[model samples]
Target: MTLVDFATSSLSVLPAIIALGLAIITRRVLISLGLGIIFGALLLTDFSLLESGKYIFNTVKGVVIEDGGINTWNMSIVAFLVLLGMMTALLTLSGGTRAFANWALEHIKDKRGASYLAAFLGVFIFIDDYFNSLAVGSISRPVTDRFGVSRSKLAYILDSTAAPMCILMPVSSWGAYIMTIIGGILLSHGIADYSALGAYVRLIPMNFYALFTLLMVFAVIWFKLDIGLMKEHEINAEARLNESHKEDEDHVDLHDEFGVEESEHGKVSDLIFPITTLILATLFFMLYTGNQALSSSELPFSVLGAFENTDVGASLCYGALVGLMFSLITVFKQKLAPKLIGKALWIGARSMFGAIIILFFAWSIGSVIGDMKTGAYLSSLVQGNIGLHWLPVILFILSGLMAFSTGTSWGTFGIMLPIAGDMAAASDISLMLPVLSAVLAGSVFGDHCSPISDTTILSSTGARCKHIDHVATQLPYALSMAAVSSVGFIVLGFTASVLMSLAASFAVFSMVIAIMKMLSKR
Candidate 1:
């Protein structure tokens, strides 16, 4: 039975709070998410046992099947994960991965070079976060592994760059979607001083968290600033390398998600060909889907329009499928028998099964959170009387908390942006850009630290790092950047100057890093 509707209340947040606490204490993602969903369902059903059971059963069912029809978007994402995993397995068996690793080992030289290579690749792929998180990992893992770079470090670099770069680059899918939201927000508020594209550009510099987080990635690498749990991870990776004492060409990475059985006839092209196909094919499908959407809609037929209208999950599935076929062909060329290829496919699919399960529950918890109107309840706290000068920083922190609890940055954006716009219009209309930008910045910061965040999950999956390890190691970095950005927003709220705030924020970040460096040395 469908539960009765309820108004937004403080009870909406209890499930998330309990879930977050349990996740921290137990480090078991599924248990935390499942309990959270149950708690949310119980609250929705008003303590009725049968109704709560139905509420939860329906939530899980709805992910794959909703309204008596297959929920293709969620299913497509699941399919894409399995397809990508299988493709990765095929590449490993083809010996292409080994050949590429050997080749990269000769050129990449040291851990520093390997770290930078991963960082740059993560930044280079900005079209979409999921693609960025997984693609960069496959390409860089061999080199990073060869040089004893910790998987946690690789995960951090991936997580930091994926969303930050996508949000910063206006040509990206994220840019397209966010611009669409801004356009409507602009029109609804009767503000026509700048076009949506123009306003997005203006908010770029004001996105302190995104800008600073990017800086922190490279800075940490360059300065050898391995703080918190990351330090222990790096040390362990180094010790493992020393203990193995194997030559680069002979070494098999224990940390690699792909198993150690590699073909003897594999070449670098085996790796290069399939990956190139995936990138090119995904781009083609993105445009195709976007154009198809624009053709039937009121929007003009342009690249931006297509991106803004694209079905991302479907595009990822089609591209991954094409890439999988190509990778299979590479494996077939090796002529290593049909059984092994089938074996590789099974192994690949199995590897992703655990992650996919976590993703399903995470999505369910998100759905539960939505039904409870948790975001609305949290946002209501901010709508009370407050000083105008503190709004930007307050909004930034609130958005971060909301995203952190909900495990969805996009959801935070949907709830907070309109409130920020309305507040800006009511207070100081000139502060509109700063306030809106804070929501974007804070959401990314929260997403970085959130265990249930999709990007966080995918980054660990790509890096083959344990999920808790990634979260634990990256927390210090995200928190530091957030601290710096917090003060910057405070400056912006008072002065209304993006330049001054950035200048002030940079000074604070520099000092914080220096202090961290000294502490690490001690």
Candidate 2:
């Protein structure tokens, strides 16, 4: 395609690509995305500075005003993230996280067990990728450190399972978003009763990346296989632990930046109560919203209306209130007054500002891409040439590369979902199986290796290791899984059986792991 042809087909895509490159090189995600938005606007508006400015304003307004302004589905993510931050803050302030970490350390003492626990928790929190990333990183970092697991490995586990697992789960926000896109594609192709939601549930078992990555996580935990930057972090942590032992300091602190020092008065009940409440509340809300049962009764203010009106702000407000109340009633009793609780709530909200800002920019870039039809144009171009048989693998790799470069799986999914869905329909592919798998796999792959990815930064932050250190160590492991997954896709494309494909993929992964272990020993 000529430059003009390419630009017209997907003008927003150029800016995103440029922004990703800038972010990777400079490690400044927000700045890169800002530039990307600008570039996308410029491309769509034909470099007319005045027109680009208008496009930018309209893009922002369009995103903000959709679905009752801030209450729209696009902004639901922002709300979810803000609530996650507040919840995390409350947990931190209550010493619940510290208590859990200490308990985890005591229970899963070995490196292998620690790794397994981290991966296990990741699977457990498959409701949302953002929550999974932040929660797992915050809660499991300390336990992993105690076992000499590298920070990068922790990040890898968190990032790998974050999007992959959630994308597979039908109840998650990721599922809702992808299904909507898939449904639209199905409708366009004259298919009726084709539920994108149903398709995702069926394809989960067959999703090569999700299956392989989960297996890889378990393998890492079980084998205690350390390579790349992870190896370096483990060696360093081991040396530090050894030296501390030799010195025999009376008050030696093993806690790193990512860990919380256990409070003497903290109890397991403190951790269990808030977490259980959070999970129950989230599930209740999701079911209530998804099923529309709350709308049937005409109360003064219907429950469904309240939920529909609820934004991230409302959710966080609710979570903060609940957390504060729980903290006072259970942890502090009457000693916790309104002022103290208010302060804690404010602290919790403020703590998530960084993440909120990142989410905003990520959303902005994605909005630009969607508005300018970059993804659709690209999808059309690709559809004309590639057969359905090979499209899945190509899209998987493409999604992975895009996510890796951008360091945002949500952004990657946002860009690829429509395109992949359209292609699946055009090529007569099983709309849900290959396309969903490709999006899920690609997103994890990108999050796995991207230096600027928030999860990567958090992993490094949690591990108390250098960020680059974590990325270098974890890249090899992620690549290995991706390779195995690619082969699995190739085999599945021809054979088209979930069980058979997964079985073959697992075998290949096992063999690869064995070879890597043998080579590492030498």
Estimated TM-score for each candidate: 0.96, 0.77
All-Cα superposition RMSD per candidate: 2.5, 5.8
Candidate with the greatest TM-score versus the true structure: 1
Expressed as tens digits, the lDDT of each residue in 341-369 for candidate 1 is 88888888888887899899888998998
lDDT of 1 at 467: 84
**Which pairs clash in model 2?**
79-312, 228-473, 229-473, 230-473, 400-442, 404-446
| Model 2: lDDT of residue 498 | 66
Q: Which portions of model 2 miss their true places by more than 4 Å? A: 1-12, 48-68, 71-86, 148-150, 176-198, 237-263, 293-321, 334-347, 399-440, 443-475, 497-500, 518-522
Give each model's whole-structure lDDT. 0.87, 0.63
Score candidate 1 by TM-score against the native.
0.96
For candidate 1, the per-residue lDDT at 114 reads 93
